[model samples]
Target chain A: MTRTVLEVRDVQKSFGAVTAAKDISVAVPEGAVFSLIGSNGAGKTTFVNMVTGYIKPDSGSIRFADRDIAGMAPRQITRMGIHRSFQIAQLCNDLTVEENMLLAGAIHGASGPSFLRRAHDPEARDRAVATLERFNIAEHRDRLVPELSGGVKKLLDIAMAMAGDTQIMLLDEPTSGVASDEKFPIMDLVMEALRSTGVTVIFVEHDMDIVTRYSERVLAFYDGRIIADDAPDEVLLDPEVQRYVTGTPA
Target chain B: MRSKLFLGATAAFAVLAAGSVILPDWAMFLCAMALAKGLVCLGIVGMMRGGVVSFGQGLYYCIGAYTATLVANSFGVSDIFLLTLLSALACLLVGMAFGPLLSSYRGIFFAMLSLALSMVLYGSLSKMSVIGGTDGLNIAAPTFLGWAPEGRPLQTALYIYVVAIVVIAGTLMRIYFDSEQGLITLATRDNELRVEYLGASVRNIMTYNYVFGAVLGGIGGTIAALALGHVDPEFAFWTTSGEFVFVAILAGYLSVPAVFVAAIILELVRSFSNLYFPNTWQLALGIFLLVVIVLLPNGLGSLVGRRKGNAA
Candidate 1:
């Protein structure tokens, strides 16, 4: 059996009158590519937030490398090698694409951010460029983030999250904002780049085609609970998943 | 790029240092005062890069002047270097004590909190009779190391001393602005949440930036105190802090060297306008600032070259 990289047991979270997560539990094996599918307000992003420590679960045990990170701060969780990219690309818009990548490398470098070393020192620049190149956005490295295309920004966001010894990456919506024709190409680039690094990927996606194509396993969420969890083909065929998540008549 | 900036800064420092020989005594004093105030404005620019503006920088400025004056009067320390050192240390301690609290604030809250703290200091200092009450205390002419120069020589020594300090501070700050931590600060300004998600503590970064600002403010206060031969609670007044903010906004957040250039310009305009316009000098300064703001929205530093993403 593949070793589990992330284990969430009986997680429960609520926001006042609304329940965002209820008894959510799932175990992700090392190097597995899993996709989360759900309708709006169906607790897909909530699970990612809890795992990445953006929102503390009201009660749950989130184990990553034998440590309970259920309520840890986002920065601490990030330092421990669990990084996540936002649904809306969270980038430094004022910085050039290369500078943004350099910042990520510098922050995650062995020495951390330094007062003495230049941010774009040769070593850091090479690493940043390499990551940008891997994401196929190296051509736009000199352009400011706001000037870049939506697809490139999303790619940069994922590329930045991939920096520093990341073992598990949770992409909220990698292809949400990309144009239809460009979505498949961007996802191909992102998946190809991510898979080569052997990092376990957990992506929340609304595109059934992407879910069927990229993910090995699928977790379908409805009303803050996982309605079905199985192979993409099996999950797509499940009556409850079709009715609740995909909005298709069963 | 780094080497080019270093060479340019060194050349500028040399030119300013040489000004002591050709400039008259009054001009020398004016330049010294301008540079000293420029140092305080530099601190404001530092905080501005981190996406917060401190309206109470006068708190550290006043503290530095008083610390130097107190040390010289009570402990008999007359060396300018020693006084500036002590003042910087004092401000560093104060910054450390207050940084964590202030780091939690942002936007207008941070500005107002800093302003309130400085006003508190101003009120306390005004009421303290032992420190000469509202009249303030006079600081004696400071000695360089052990040498005591009188009159013109003394003014020249102080002018050269201010020039050297400004150059050193400006050069060091330029390196800092280009450093990894400095880039993190600029990133924080743009998207703080993204910075946190990148595994860096935004609060810690803000705290460090605040402490640096405090230390620079302290040093500037010491230089100003020495140049003016006096210390007063007015140093902590809101209006005095407002002048530092004005210089910072005028300088923009782009370049460290532009900060001093803006300060020097403000001082020159104030002096000349007072001579020519008299009662309308404030109006003249206001008009000049408006013109600069309207023409160069990014401040004079834009004339140099725009560095992508707030690179100082």
Candidate 2:
């Protein structure tokens, strides 16, 4: 059996009148490509946000490796080997792709301030180049992120997160803005590259085909609760899971 | 790239040295004043890179000027370079103390807080009689090493000294802005959240630049005090800080060189407008600034940058 890298136990979060998550418990094994699928406001994003330390959950615990990461800041969690990418890429618009990648590589290695270290030093530059090459974004090294296409920016966003030494990554809508035909290819590239690194990935996805094709384990959320959790084929074919997927009555 | 920058700096130094020898007294004096103010504006450019616009830089300027002036008054230490360096170092320590506190604020809040602090300094300076009070204090005629030149020789020597200091400081700042730490300031402005998640504390970086800028302002004030032969509470006034902010805006945050260009242009305009319309000189400046901002939101450096991009 694969060693568990992240375990969520009864994690619950709410916003006044809205419940974002409820009694969500799951165990993601190391090196597994885990995908979350649900309808609008099904608490998938909220779950990802909590696990990645963007929001403090109302109850329950988010343990990464062995330590509880319930109340940590995003930066603290990132330092502890948990990182996330936004639904829309959160990138420094004016910085070159290579600069952005080097920053990630530097952050991945050094826990302290990097005031004097050159961003294009041999190690960082080589790592950034290698990550870019993996994401098929090496040619856009000098191009500013704001100028890149949405598809390329999405890919670059993932590349930046991967540039770091992360054990688990929470990707919020990784393929949200990409064209339908391009979604599978993007996920395929991300999963394949990360597989070699032995990193666990928990991604929120909307496409059923891509979800089934890539994810070893699939989870479906219904009204802030995990209603389905199993192998992709089994979970996707579950009767209650189908109802949530199609937004139909029981 | 290093060789090219080195060559450019050498050529710049040669031109400035030559200008100091050949230029008329009035023009040389004007250039010296502009170069001093240019140092202060360069510091503002550094902060601007980190998404901050301070309106209290006059506080540091006041600290440097007053420190240098009081030292000269009480100790009779007249070596200009030594006193100036000592004053700048003191101001840097003061800046580092305030950096973390100031880094907590940004946008208009940061601007206003800085303005309020400088006003406090101005009020205290005006009330204190020990430092000359409302009459202000006069810094003695400073000597370089052991030589004290008077008349035209003094003017020429002072101009050459000021130019050398400005050139060396500006070159060092250029090297800094090109470094990894410097490039990260721009990124911090662009996205503070992303910067934090990337494992660099935004506050730490901002604090670093803030203290660095404060030191530049201090050096500017020291040079100005030495050249003008006076130090006053008026140096701590809001209007003084406003002029530095104005120059920063005009220069754009694109590069270190832009700050000097903008400083020179500002001095020229102020001199000309004051000569022709002394009462409405500020009005003239306001109108000119409006036009520039309307036409080039990124400041004049972007224009130069675009031209270079096209040439390349």
Candidate 3:
């Protein structure tokens, strides 16, 4: 009885004469690991920006949990339990890792029912520490973000998005630019963490290995449009998707 | 750690109050001026930390002075409390009218626009015959509630300093640095896109920051008017805005209380330079600023808390 958690219907966006996303539609069911894989300039991030309310679409409707979130502000979207991480891993470079989690926890935990008093409540601190430990970076929690390695910073970024009891999470290129050896383990941790939380997850990724490994469904975007949406194997085998990923058909 | 921090503030307050009592008239004057200026600089601190540098505070400062002066002169009203309240209301109205416009600009453009707007006010005041024009209007030393400031200068200075420290440093500054929305302001400064992804509107945050900074500037302007006992278009000049910005950078924007310390030091230096090196006072101040900027990129407060992190 898992419900369709997020639905984007006929969304379209453009910049000047360039169309970024055209008549795009997507539906992510509850607790599913849905992934969109495209090369650079394939409009994946643009679609994400629209869904997160960072950019207004030229036309379309968006809904989450039967609620129209078409043009809602990002803060309102976040308050509705949808949180996102960035492709660049926007760590608070000045603050410690623990402090970053504390801020995220404060944002999520302090919402609704005694929101102001909950700000000074002691439980928020305990929750921050526990979330840090979940990412296996708890030992370095006290260290500044700039001091952490790229992989560790990414881990902390994902950990922050997970701090609140969010039902849906959108991560842009979760493992981009990570050292080759660190990639699988970090993705393993991310997938394992999301699985345990039962959070519906959608992410933009480039690597086919990671996509097939983590996602139940693969969404293929080529020229600002969803060309194929199916099981990873089916999408991988599709002629158009294969042509888009690797030049020329075999 | 929090308790220790509170204790340290208490100790600093006591020492400053005691010094005010023991110092000569000139020293007391410098301290009172510093406190008033420090209170105004809090608005700059709030604005800068939110990643916006303002050069329009002269507008609020002038608003406060003119409101108080007009009331005391024309209405023949002499109640200090009543004057402050009226001036504060005037500042709030100005802020409300200007907030949306100020919120529309950012970076150097915003700074220049604010400076231009304040200069317009300065120009108007300088030419207007209603308030003594360029010569400026004189104001009598206000009686607080009922007690006159003539014989009780120390008591009056201490009382105003206490108010400045408590209201400016304690409440408004606290909201700027420590609130949840405060953290969001930092987030907006660091990465607007990231904050948007987290579900916060960057535009709304900037507007709120503008309004808050304006409110603080208004309060500080009102306090300065009462302390100086004068109203002049000169206070709204671009140079006054520049001085506020310079002190903000010199003190570093890390802690709110640091603005007070920076203001006090600057006023003391100004006074001493006027006394000993009257011919090249401005040159001495310029060189001092250059040295401070070169040596401490984070400002004076960074020297105090260098152990924690780099300049905030």
Candidate 4:
């Protein structure tokens, strides 16, 4: 059996009277591509946030590589090899695409960022450009981030998260802002780039078609609980998942 | 590009140093004071890059001036170099103490908190009678490594010294602004959340920037105090802090050199306006600021060239 990379057991979180996560428990095996499917307030993002250390679970443990990582700051968790892309692309609008990539490389570089070394030295530029090329966004590297299209911004956001030695990549709606026609292509590029590195992928996506196509395992969430957990076909076919998550009558 | 900047800085330093010989003593003194104020403004510019404006940098400025003055008076140590170094060291210690707390704040909270701290210093200094209270204390003319010069020669020596200090400080600041940590500061200003998520500590970056600002402010204050031959509570007053902010806003957060240029311009304009209009000099300064803001929203530094494509 493949080793478990992320193990979430009895995780619970609440916001006042409303429960955002209700004893959510799941174990993600190494190199598995998991897609979280849920309706509007179904705890899908809460799960991602807790795992990425964006939110603290009120109870229970989240273990990554056998170490409990609950309540750690986002940066600490990120340095521990779990990285996430935001639902809305987080980019430095004033900077060019290449500069953004260069910044990421500098931040996650082996020596860490330095006060004496130039940030955009030739080596950093080359590495940034190479990453941009992998995402097929190298052509737009010179353009400022604000000037880029929504699809390009999303690509850049995910690309930046790929910096350093990321073990598990959590993508929060990787293709949310892209045009309908461009979603599959973007996902294909992202998945190809990620899969080649053998990093585990967990993406939160609203598109059922994309989920069915890309995810090896699917999780359906409803009212702060996992309603269905199995392969994509099995989960999609589950009556409760169809009823609550996909809004389809079984 | 680095070589070019180094050459340009060298050329500028040479011209300014050369000016001391030809210019009148009053002009040299004015230039020295303007550059001193520019150093404080440079500190503000440093923090501004991290997306925070400090309204109370005068706290460090006052601390620096007072530290230098107290050391000089109490020990009869009149070396300008030693005084400035001590002033910087004092500010560094104070900055380390306050930086973490201040770094936790952002936007107007940081501004007001810093401003409040400076006002507190101003108030306390105003009440201290032994330190001369509202009248403040006078500083003896500074000597250069045991070589005490009086009259015109003294002013010229001070002017040359100020020019050299500014050149070195400005060059080091430029290098810092282009360094990895400096770019992180710029990125922090743009989107602090993203910076944190990228595995870097935003608080640490902000704290470092704040400490840098404090040191720069201290050095500037020491220079100003030495040039004026006086240390006063007015140095910590809100209006004095506001003037440094004015220069910072006028300079923008772009090029390091633009800061001093903006400072020199403000000094010249204020001097000429005070001479010509006397009563309406404040009105003149206000108009100048408004005009510059309207013409260059990014400040005078934007005119140096759009900072794009890693052109620094």
- Return the TM-score for each candidate structure: 0.98, 0.92, 0.91, 0.98
Per-residue alpha-carbon lDDT of candidate 1 for residues A9-35, written as tens digits (9 for 90 to 100): 999999999999999999999999999
Residue-pair clashes per candidate, as listed?
0, 0, 4, 0
Better of 2 and 4 by DockQ: 4
| Clash pairs for candidate 4 | none
* lDDT digits (tens) for residues A134-185 of candidate 4: 9999999888887888899999999999988999999999989899999999
- Candidates ranked by DockQ, best first? 4, 1, 2, 3
Candidate 2 residue A100 C-alpha distance from true site, Å:
3.2
TM-score of chain A of each: 0.99, 0.94, 0.93, 0.99
Give the 10-residue window scoring lowest on summed lDDT in candidate 4 chain A. Answer: A115-124
Model 3's alpha-carbon lDDT is: 0.76
What tier of docking accuracy does candidate 3 attain?
acceptable
Q: Tell me the lDDT of candidate 1.
A: 0.92
Better of 2 and 4 by TM-score: 4
- A best-first ranking of the candidates according to their lDDT comes to 4, 1, 2, 3
Report the Cα lDDT for residue B244, model 1. 93
Task: Kindly list the per-residue Cα lDDT of model 4 for residues B1-312, writing each as its tens digit.
Answer: 689779988998999899898988788888999998899899899999999999999999999999999999999999999999999999999999999999999999999999999999999999999998989999999999999999998898888898998999898888888888988999999998899999999999989989999999999999898889898899999999999999999999998889999999999999999999999999999999999999998899999846757423
lDDT of 2 by residue, A1-250 (tens): 8898888998889999899999999988888889999998999999988987778998899888678999788888888888788899989877788878876776676544355555566776788888899999898888888778887898888888876678998888988989878887888888888888888888898888888888889899999889999999888778898887745444
- lDDT for each of the candidates? 0.92, 0.84, 0.76, 0.93
- In CAPRI terms, model 1 is classed as medium
Interface RMSD of 1: 2.2
Off by over 4 Å in 2: A109-127, A246-250, B306-312
